[model samples]
Target: MRIIISPAKKMIVDTDSFPPEGLPAFLPRTERLLSALRSMSPAALQALWKCNDAIAALNVERLAAMDLSRSLTPAILSYEGIQYRYMAPTVFEQSQLDYIRTHLRILSGFYGLLRPFDGVTPYRLEMQAKLAVDGCRDLYAFWGGTLAEALAAETNLVVNLASKEYSKAVEPHLPASVRFLTCTFGEEKGGKILEKGTACKMARGQMVRWMAEHGIDRAEDLRNFDGLGYAFSPAHSTESNFVFLKGDT
Candidate 1:
């Protein structure tokens, strides 16, 4: 399982050949909605950045507990080369990873309302795609507001993804300064899996167990694995949040 992380979408980990389907499906919609946002527009992505930064700030203590798990869990990645299986070497890099992880978590939370967190399942992918479309729409509208309102609106709106009455629930919560935009990417283009085999049959928990069986405990070990690569953040949400805040501030 070769995993490659690139700064290009904030540590996007490519497991086989492409991002999960929901993300790709959602990408073009988001792009079309947010067409006003130029490529890699800092202003456009800032709300997302602030939300992640806030979460990392809350994750500090939770992060400490995770190092212990790394020692106990040797099947996921080989922790032998890394000082702590769950941690990045420098605080800086850790923050980068955390920022990405935190936002992904928020995204997951949203989809959780409608689907399970199945990495490649059709339903999960579809829900993720919907979120990608909806989220970018809201985020782009945020820039017209004061920075604080924009950040708050982005966070709360994203949180709403999991809401049962997202449309009604979010409208009251959103700052009036922000408005939804329309964006699209890829036009629901199909994707290819360059990897030789599939990990689609494996549930996320099963995949983790498989990794543990191999005594793989660090992020780097996936480089030699034959299937997919996953980017992980410790389960401790609070600690992840602390890391987010420390880095973004």
Candidate 2:
């Protein structure tokens, strides 16, 4: 089984920490995108990033200074978001790290797909960003079916922990042979299933840690996931969609 998650916009660079396993598989392609970004003015970059002045300035510097070949932090350690914080990879044992390396993948607009330990530098681009590269109209179009093909090569079963923006890059393009399953973290409130952003992010991370600790390798095994007050709901779940309710019985 393989699991896919989104890369966080918020990142940290630790040049002295864990040695990067290697560069991203899509380095050449990433260079192509970087070429486009390198040409953009700060204002254009700011628009593309859709962020405030401070974030735009930071990313402008990042784009100007990024050297893809340089030594960098592991992809897992670089992303510092709510999900990553809950996953808490910094304290993981070697065995847990091994498990994560084999099963977890981080989807990115810049890198396309990344193994947990892949070397990466800080940059600001989102999967849903409207920036076009080469002949492709958007990041999704630029990535095309490459992400799905990569995932198919790795495993027959894919557990999607990625948000819609990133997952859309792969889900529709997956081969028929691959079995794709998505886990939803939400709560039942007033007869509706309400999904809160931060809570879902936390649950996604917790689920990954729980899976690693329990040596879970099968999709069906996830039904037993009860991390962070979530319990799998048979009524809310389908063969391809596993829904975990946070506060309901």
lDDT of each: 0.25, 0.92
Cα TM-score per model:
0.20, 0.98
In candidate 2, which residue pairs clash? Answer: none
Model 1 agreement with the true structure over 1-249: per-residue lDDT tens digits:
111110111211123432222222233333343343233244334443343644443332223232211122111111111112122212224344333333322221112211111131111111112223434444323222322232353353221111122233233444644332110001111332121111221222233233334544333442233322333222312310211111111
Task: For candidate 2, write residues 107-218 as lDDT tens digits.
Answer: 9999999999999999889999998898889999999999999999989999999899899999999998999999999999887888999999999999888887887899
